[model samples]
Target: DAGVTQSPTHLIKTRGQQVTLRCSPKSGHDTVSWYQQALGQGPQFIFQYYEEEERQRGNFPDRFSGHQFPNYSSELNVNALLLGDSALYLCASSLVQGSNTGELFFGEGSRLTVL
Candidate 1:
């Protein structure tokens, strides 16, 4: 079974630029959630995608958006990135939505460094 995977394990972006990160969910999984983990902190939920639509979302602003494909893979798009956007963007996959007690398998993450 293939576990979650993310692209470009590291990234460098300047302020005001836009960036897109990718994620492939675990095998047999159907739900994907995006999170932003700042340095020295736990991840904060960005949004969740299931059935190719946004099933849920966190407190993130409009600048943060995402999309999930029929194959259960997903993408996170950050527009007009800010310095504060510098963080590890993690992608987590679950077998089902609300079936487990929020236990998630995370990818290594796409590290975005903003200047």
Candidate 2:
């Protein structure tokens, strides 16, 4: 039973560049959520994906996009990256019941640096 796992672990990018981060949910989890955490701030919700569709989104700009595969894995794509995009990208897995998402299991996260 592996838990939520994210890839790239750490990466660096220049402004205007694009990056794609991947995530695999824990067993039996069907929903995946993406979050961004600044140096000292808590995680801010980016979006939620379920059944291969984006079910919810946060206040991020249109440059942020995502996709969920049928196998429950997900990918977060950030385009036209800015310095402000430097942060820890987190992947959380949960089970969606009706309109609510149950407790989330988070991965170690991918650290993105924009220079």
Question: How would you encode candidate 2's per-residue C-alpha lDDT over 1-115 as one tens digit per residue?
Answer: 9999999999999999999999999999999999999998999999999999999999999999999998999999999999999999999999998899999999999999999
Error of 2 at 24 (Å): 0.1
- C-alpha local distance difference test of each model: 0.92, 0.98
Q: Give the alpha carbon lDDT tens digit for every residue of 18-98 in model 1.
A: 999999998888889999999999899999888898888899999999999888899999999999999999999987735
Error of 2 at 90 (Å): 0.3
Clashes of 1: 0
Query: Could you report the Cα RMSD, in angstroms, for every candidate shown?
Result: 1.5, 0.5
**TM-score, per-candidate, Cα-based:** 0.94, 0.99
| Runs off by more than 4 Å, candidate 2 | none
Give the TM-score comparing model 2 with the true structure, all chains together: 0.99
